[model samples]
Target: MDHRFVGIPELTAVPRVAVVVDVMRAFTVAAWAFSRGAERIVLAPTVEEALALKEGRPGWLALKDGAPAAGFDAVNSPGLIRSRDFAGRTLVQKTTAGTVGALAVADAPLVLCASFVVAGPTARYLRAGAAGPVTFVVTGEDGRADEDLACAQYIGAHVSGGRVDPAPYVHRARNSRAAADLGAGRRAGCHPDDVELCLEVDRFPFAMVARREDSLTVLRPVTAPVNPAR
Candidate 1:
């Protein structure tokens, strides 16, 4: 298998597997929600699309700017969603980077949304299914987040059967300007608690696989038929 890492801005080919990396918050929240029992995650290209989705479902939660959209049950914040009971609810997600990145590569055969929380399992899953080209799309806040690319590199390295310490990259993320802004002064966009969850590497044992369902791309964890190659 040939694995390569590139920022979302540079992605071109439609590989066998396209892993969308958004460790900042979107996918971190996703991992938390799935871990806590959310049935599936539906990615919306924009707030408009997400709103349209809510119109059809009428009860699914909507998230905007990391907070629950008006009248929704929960927000996109992992810290917030982890406390809510989402046993069978399908979450509608719209975010700055994660979902956008996923939609950007809709041509790929296999699209997997991942964060640091599921990095190891994601790597394992990709390794098990390796048959050809695999590309890691680092969706970093409009191609400016180092942490996102760092995570992509981390996963890519692991996929190639290489070892790299994750602590330094995680440390860099903690002290990043974005982290500082979100932790010290922001309450609406992100907070310390949110960053904390995003940095929990390998917290989940499954990877979120995105499957296109008509107009929606749904993400669900595949946990059966373990086939770890290494």
Candidate 2:
């Protein structure tokens, strides 16, 4: 299967084996929540909808949209998910890029939520399913290329096999002086620990899958079947 690069919104037509990456924050937060014992997480496309979801499920924690600006509950920060006392409660997350990306790919044949932290497991999840073109649905900054796309590239190269190169993103990420300039503009969102969490490789073997019910997207964990190749 030939691998192709597409914008986040184009993930809808991707074949059954597609990986979703929100490395900068979203998936990292989801993984953190799972680690924190959150029963489940509802991926809402927008903050308003997420809030509405909380109304129906009183115990779910809320996270607003993150884009040009951080929304109400902050940009789905891992700090928030980890810091909160979410023993048995669920989290309702709405991110401008991640959630929108999830919505766009709602019809993918097999969608697995992923990030660098669980890149190895995500790859295992894809390979175990079947041989099909895998699209890394990376959520970008309001249609603009950002870290998420690079994270997707890394995971894609990891799972898809063949000669892989990382010089592209390593150079870009290292030289990205935008942090100096955008610091004033970049919203106070993801926590410092979150940055570390998002960068980890093979931190876990869980694959988060989205299940559409009525309108909201419910995230559920899918354990990789024991595979020595993984």
Candidate 3:
């Protein structure tokens, strides 16, 4: 399968499979939430919509980043997500980049939400099931999210039938401006531990896949073996 990397603006050209990457904390948070037993996550393109989904709904929670929404349970930080008990809960997530990117490619045949935490499993899933071209959507401003781009490269190298050390990519992500902002606590509702949490490669053993469920784009975890002798 041919692997192509594109940014948010190029999403309209996406082919069969589209992987939306947001390592700076959006998809990472989803990874953690799924690992923690979240039943399903609804992707919201806007903070207002996410808040609307949570209204009067039992077992539903809203999570977002940037200026706080009125009823959001928490921010999109993996550090905070790690300790929460999300068992049987449905999360409505609205992020500055990641969720928007995923929703943008909702028309694609297959959509996968990705971060370093689930990169290995995602790559394996693609190798086994993807029959057409795969596109990695880097969900950052101006198509220049260093950490997200690094994660796309890491996963792409694996899917290309070769394995490259993830060290360099991890290093590049750690020193990125986004990492610096989170490390210095400049971003609202973000924790200092989030930088490390987002950079932890292969932390979870499942790939987060998105599917259209009625009017919502829902994400759930799919566990694929590290190496399948197919």
Compare the candidates by TM-score and give the number of the best one.
Answer: 3
Best by lDDT: 3
**RMSD of model 2 against the true structure:** 3.7
Candidate 2 TM-score versus the reference: 0.80
**How would you encode candidate 1's per-residue C-alpha lDDT over 69-155 as one tens digit per residue?**
564556667776777777887888888888888988876788888888888788787778756788888787656687787777778
For each candidate in turn, the TM-score is 0.90, 0.80, 0.96
Q: Kindly list the per-residue Cα lDDT of model 3 for residues 73-119, writing each as its tens digit.
A: 87888887798999999999998899989988998898999999999
List clashing residue pairs in candidate 3.
none
Number of clashes in every candidate structure? 0, 0, 0
lDDT string, candidate 2, 1-230, tens digits: 44555667565454666566776667877877787688888887766777777777666677763432422344566655666666787788877667677767777767777766666666666667746777666566543455666666766776668334655754443333322223343645544465555556667768788777676677877786556253
After TM-score superposition, what is the CA distance of residue 67 in candidate 2 from its true location, in Å? 11
Q: Cα lDDT of all candidates, in order? A: 0.78, 0.64, 0.88
Clashing residue pairs for model 2: none
